[model samples]
Target: MKNSQLYIITLVVLTFLGCKELEPRRPKEHSTTNFYKEVIEQNKKLNALETKRIKQTLDRDTLTTYQSSANGFWYTYINKDTVSSQTPIKGDIVTVKYNVTGLQGNQFYDYQTRDYTVDKEDFVPGLTEGIKLMKKGETITFVIPSYRAYGVTGDGSRIGINQTLRSTLTLIEIKKPNNETK
Candidate 1:
């Protein structure tokens, strides 16, 4: 009985000693400054590439009359209808038809006619600015850089990362803030 107990104790001790205690895995530590620097550098590179691609597209399409906007998008009105000369403000609701495309001419979305409130935060900066330049019945075409559209992290699907977007907007109607609820 003593021999068996001794053997058991020895076995237990051997087993306990042989077994390794599991350590919790810790993620690698990175400096925030370094991470921020890397992000800034990557943004610079992406901007450079996007600019080059835009230049190439403009050259290929032979687009020379596009006026550069203060916010970096290139735009030109294709047609202007002699309706109301009044453009939209932030509180005004605007009815528009738009076709959004990529630099390679891939269409993203097309709306024959839709209504949107002129909220800058709700849409891309390029589209918001583009709409502000239009009056009722005016149609404008805009070539938006990636920074103004989806930016570095795209729209999570058809639009890839750092992709430039081209969009054409036709303002169908403009409703005043008091008349917009209907």
Candidate 2:
């Protein structure tokens, strides 16, 4: 699977989790009882299905399974070149300029505030993880899955479910949101 394709799959999970669907017996918090267990099982099957779909649809002969960390809400990768480590942590305010696109190459979120929230539960899982992996003046690309994004219900017109998302993220700057000093 290509990174781009992997990104889409992750977005699906992200969006699915982000969706606040109200179930009759569902609690206020995100519902795990409704379909998460089944959903996870389905996701495993779907992942395989997606891998096949991508390889067949794109006619990719040299496709490799693109992998993302399954443990955390967020993950990061240093550019193949950069060496230093100044990893981002929770509560770190950051400024980023990004362009989110889909498989057909549709534009989504354009650059706005670099100091956006790094909240895991707010945005999709892939995005929440992809952004915090940068330093001042750094750019990275992400291929997020729908599950990790807006899921099937999606967030109005801004995002769609089961649709893979592509992003070229540039970390403009990193600063504390409320704190004035170190």
Candidate 3:
């Protein structure tokens, strides 16, 4: 109908009339320099507080240190980059995916399979700490210190204390006896 056509034309004109490209904001309008500056200041303050807390909680003489706090929660590697954390409980058989490098930066193991759960008692304090913080497929880097590791006496094997071991671990699955699993 003629009336219907007129209405359609009017609708089309109204829709097109206000169509315009969006204007980009000026630098001043989009400037987030102030916001970033505030965030940086806050981060610095937090870092200072964390540093103090770590110093108070950790023993400078000991190689392996455990931290449980809101500021930071991790077992810092003392002598080497040996990963560790106490969150997963000590003496648990945890499935892990890991890549390990020696103090000389030699890649000893870089296994990436889903079947890598290690016994807590078998691993050093550092490794135990690391396993606690892992979830399925979560990768983490550990800069283990000497105390939580094979110390000055060494593990009588490949790893030693005062040695920084680098380990990137992924938790594939957690398993134990009496638990149904595939």
Which candidate comes out best when scored by lDDT?
Answer: 1
Shift of residue 133 alpha carbon in model 3, Å: 1.1
Candidate 3, residues 13-131, lDDT tens digits: the string is 98898686768876656548988999889757755664554455354527554554332334332233234432333333556666667544687666655443445255655766667
TM-score of 2: 0.59
* Candidates sorted by TM-score, best first: 1, 2, 3
Candidate closer to the true structure by TM-score (higher is better), 2 or 3: 2
**Per-candidate count of clashing residue pairs (backbone under 3 Å):** 0, 35, 24
lDDT of 3 at 148: 51
- Cα error, residue 136 of model 2, in Å, equals 1.8
Candidate 1 per-residue C-alpha lDDT over 53-145 given as tens digits, one digit per residue, 9 for 90 to 100? 887777777655677789889887799756655788887888889888887789887656778888734776788888988887788889999
lDDT of 2 by residue, 12-62 (tens): 999998897866875567666767788788888876665455445334423
Task: TM-score winner between 1 and 2, please give it.
Answer: 1
Residue 107's C-alpha lDDT in candidate 3? 76
Worst 10 residues of 3 by lDDT: 69-78
| Local lDDT at 77 for model 2 | 34
| Residue 90, candidate 3: alpha-carbon lDDT | 37
Model 3 has how many clashing residue pairs?
Answer: 24
Q: What is every candidate's alpha-carbon RMSD to the true fold?
A: 5.6, 24.1, 18.3
